[model samples]
Target: MLITVGDDTATFDAFDQSSQVHTTIPCDTSEPGQVLLPHRTLHDVVAKLPDKPITITHMGSAAQFTCGPRTFELPPMTLDDYPPLPDMPPAVGTIDWSDLAAAIREVGAAAGRDDTLPMLTGIKVDSHDGALTLAATDRFRLAHTTLPWDGDDLDMLIPARDILTLARTTWHGDVTIHHDQRRLGFTLGDTRTILRLIDADFPKWRPLIPKDSDTTIRIDRKTMADAVKFTSVLAGDTGQVVLSITSGQVTIASKTAQDGAGEEVIACDTVGNELNIAFTSRYLLDALAGDGTALMTFTQPGRPAMVWPDLPCEEGKVPDADRGHLLMPVRLPG
Candidate 1:
């Protein structure tokens, strides 16, 4: 199929050389099989006609095109010309799409890259004997959950970003994960995405996750989050937001040399002894965003604090309900 660019008064071949990305011009809206330009050739041509229309035609094959002042049609694209579709499982397993997305976001928010930090950008997808375990860590905290899925063989370490993207793009449904050591593929709806898997050995993060805690606090998530965010303004590079919990009120405060100090108090149903805890405002923000508006449960003092969304997050109320986050307390400077 042949495609033309611009009007006959100033017509030119539309082609690019740098990258293989789809390009469309304003006037000529190309249809499905219209070969306006080869993928690689389209890049160079895009800059020239940023404000024009590109028209493509299917010269000798079945083709149709129509759109305002633009059109597109194409000869049949051969199988060899198209990238192969990602493999799909003959039998699929059910997974909560929202939950998987949340898991990736939670881990990505906490993961730190340092000599002391192990790789946390990887999510381990283990089709365990019966359940699929998704786990992540960043030396300071670990996040994990097991979902039911039927599959054989073993585990796959998918890059966290790829899975997060999938979460945003795909809605809940039967998910098929096809993998071949080097890449992980996800099939959802009419789209399929494949990404390279992280091959580094992930640390044994389960042990780092605290099982039992001596102190815990359950409080309104929004109140605490607002307090932290507002007070953190003056927190500077250290960005410290201190949580001082008493029998009745949980106070969040922060101070910096250039900016003054302020505190916000919110009532809470306390558990265990009251204590003072300090955390990076950044970390707490991530935790709060993940907690949504549920009654968040906080566990442990001077340790990674867990935030859990209540039993049922109100409909349309839990924007971030799919996630749970842990914040590590920072040692307040004397």
Candidate 2:
């Protein structure tokens, strides 16, 4: 780590050589010099100091910190041993902070946690014309969302954990992105982070989404979520729940030999034919985490189901661009 102090600003730069997670934070300060500080020691000393203005001075081989009435001295390390920060590549594009954060939360839920399949642990970001698509899948289910952006055709896969961490912490307003084949960088407010791109190729997920469905049900998102929660207690080892849609209601049920069975019903407006299907309770719960105003579409007893927020749209048609989750159904044991 390297700490550089200027007349008006102070910068702290640190890099994790193995993970390729590098960050630089620059903020207003009155000090003017540079030094290589022990990262952990400096952090601990500063954190425990009084909340008053702090004064730091270099005294030959040691550094002095004065806060209020107390004084502390620390030995400084040789600045020559610090490594240089990585250079930023050319600017690729920019994205709104809120949009990027929301996309990460929506898509990251489907990113696989298994390290054995490296590609499934990444989130694919694809930009074309004026739209940006973010997607992730874990074999059993997939989640995707798109937002408006202005950029040329570009595609990249970033480690899901790193991007999600930045989105939750450092993103404040608009974020400028810089990329070049193997690496990517994000600049937000006073912090800039550079990460190495994942080398594995992401799966082609477009064809996995079914274009049409035979049954579409409009129900209160909260009502459906509640029913699933109420019935999941008996899901047992399979973590399965059955959904039977008929007439004006949808019934959710689960049962196991060791655990007692449970069922809950929610009123819903239906279109097309009545259908029955089964799914993992956790998957359905994740897909319905937001406000309960979206609709769930089903194709057949064994096909994947699509769930999306009920945004303004044509009388009876849902747009293809609406943010949603594509959840695969579980084969019911006969």
Candidate 3:
């Protein structure tokens, strides 16, 4: 980590080589020196300090921090030992922070946690037309969302861990993205984040998403989410929950020998034919939590089902290229 202090701003920069996560934050302070400070120690000291203005004065070989009546001195490491920050490459495009953050939260949950398969651990970002599409999958389930953006048609794979961190921490502002062959940069306000792109090729996700479905069900998002949460209690080790749609009702149920069984029925508008499917409760819950749409759509049964906020469309047609979740169904036991 490197800490540089300029006349009007102070910056803290750190990079994790293994995870390829880099973060930079600019502080609103008027300091004019540079120092190398241990991250953990600085965090601990500041956390324990009183909620008052703190003064830090750099000594010859150490720094003194004075908060109210208490004063503490900490030795600083040589700045030369720190690695230099990477330079931002040519700008590929720019996007609103809110849109990028929402997309990350929606799709990042589906990213594979196991590091052995590096490609599945990242999100594939593609820009086309006037929108940016972000997608991720863990084999079992795939999630994606699209938001408006201005950029040339291009694609990049970014580590999910780094993008999620930036999404959660960045302020509400436009994020300028820059990339080259190896590194990707996100600039928000005065803070900039540089992430090393994963070298592996992302899974071919386009074919995995079904273009159309035989069955489509529209239900109240909150009611369905609540039912899933209630039934998940009895889902047990398999963590599987079943959904059966017939007529005007959708039944969410789960059963286990040790935990017994539970079910909740919610009213829904059904189209096509009656269908039944099973899914991992956690994956479904994550998708539900990501979107704020009042109503959600569920399509198909045997294959992956698409779930998205209800779009303003004519009674019988689904919109083309809208933000949504696509979850693969698990085979129910006979």
Each model's lDDT: 0.57, 0.81, 0.77
TM-score of each: 0.67, 0.84, 0.88
Residue 313, model 1: Cα distance from true site in angstroms: 19
Locate the minimum summed-lDDT window of 10 residues in model 1.
Answer: 14-23
lDDT score for candidate 2 against the true structure: 0.81
Q: Comparing candidate 1 with candidate 2, which one achieves the higher TM-score? A: 2
- On residues 1-334, what C-alpha lDDT tens digit does candidate 1 reach at each position? 1233443222222212211111223343333332332533443444444355443455655334434454444344443454423343333344566665656665665554453433566676676567666776565555565666666555767666555655565457655555676665555554445566676787766545444444455666667778888898877778898888788778889877778888898887665567788887876776666444544344455666656565443222221332355556778656
The order of the candidates by TM-score, greatest first, is 3, 2, 1
Residue 25, model 3, lDDT: 44
* Model 1 spans with C-alpha error above 4 angstroms: 1-99, 112-118, 127-130, 170-172, 290-301, 311-324
Off by over 4 Å in 2: 17-81, 311-319
Query: What residue runs in model 3 are displaced by over 4 Å at the alpha carbon?
Result: 18-31, 44-51, 68-73, 290-301, 312-318
**Top lDDT prediction, candidate number:** 2
